[model samples]
Target: MSTTPDRRILIAEAALDLIAREGLRALTHRAVDRDLDLPAGSSSYYFRSRGALLDAAVRRLAQNSRDAFTRSGLEAPERTDDVDASARAVATTLDEMLLRRRRDLLVRYALAVDPTIDPELHALLATGLFSRDAATTLMAAHRSTQPATAAADFVGLVEGLVADRLIGARSRDGIRAGTADSVEQLARSIAVFLRGLPTESTGTRPI
Candidate 1:
């Protein structure tokens, strides 16, 4: 009588761990099988092809990233309907979402780091979800003043910050008590800039 492992759980979790710890480039059906201490062909049983496994993994990564954004973004606004307040919220949300998602964001970053992925996948990587959200927040707060052109600018700000942090231009505070302080400061600066602009149409609630 031999004990067999629950193959599905073993593979799915191993795929995620591989992506999280190493990167998408390092993931392969055979490698995942090895990582899980299972015999070869187990991964192929669950996911028929490499494309299938990557498809599943990318979908999981998208949902996880979106959820992280919503968790921090959807909180009750500390200053509702005010330009400064909304900007603060966006900035705070950006840092909180990025920092809170240590492994997921890092994995996403790592995936894009390699230039060998499918071109379509790389295109998806370039899309900026946070920028759109930030613009919506800022324009909703002060549409009457500067005009609602925040879509590009706001996204640029968050993207720049994330890039800076990842590349060392931004200060390192994550995993420390000072992380909150740095994020809070970023929130204030963004709020100040956004408040000065004219608002756009009221933004929609997250779908």
Candidate 2:
């Protein structure tokens, strides 16, 4: 019942872990309290309602993602100019998510498809691990004719790649694919995608 920041974060993280391990239906205030081994009504005291708890979990997910990105050096401006470096940076980040932070990604995907989730929260999870704005900047640095469109395509491709590794038929192989293999494979794909983009000199075509 105490209003400590750490307790709120603990509740939210417990909720995310519950969703990842047991699915969204298992995520109740009492369930979160049980997961955290907190006193009865502890989670509810902080979150007040199911929706609030879900919001806190989503926010925690986003915060964790942003922290990971920052740690991956994706925010470095110098890397954008070099497509291969950018690709590797992104690939490394993806590898981290797919392996170390798999639970967070699973929780994100689970929440994404649930209609009961808030529209704003839905928007928050829509971007997946990387934002379109970051992709747009990368595309612009690569001299894409239409950076926004290129960014959309890039984000979509990355999303599919991650999803395939996480839940698609490739899931088994992806799990066996270690960090070196995963990062190399993803970096290659990203490099090829960046290279295939229509550049400014190629000129834009009618949409």
Top candidate (TM-score): 2
lDDT of 2 by residue, 1-207 (tens): 655998888888899999999999998998888878888998898899998999999999999988887787766454234677778878888887887888998999998999888899998898647788888877877778888999899989999888988899778773443468888977888888876876686564212
Q: Provide the TM-score for each candidate, comma-separated.
A: 0.71, 0.90
Clashing pairs in 2: none
Which lDDT values do the candidates have, in the order given?
A: 0.61, 0.83
After the best TM-score superposition of candidate 1, give how far the Cα of residue 91 lies from its true spot, in angstroms: 3.2
Relative to the true structure, candidate 1 reaches a TM of: 0.71
70 Cα displacement, candidate 2 (Å): 1.3
Residue 98 in model 2: shift from native, Å? 0.7
Off by over 4 Å in 2: 1-3, 79-81, 174-178, 201-207
After superposition of all CA atoms, the RMSD between model 1 and the true structure is 6.1
lDDT of 1 by residue, 1-207 (tens): 432344554566677679888777788999898998878887898789887777556656666657666676543333245554565556666666566655656666776777766666655555624535545544554453432456566667777776666555454645321366656667776665665554334343221
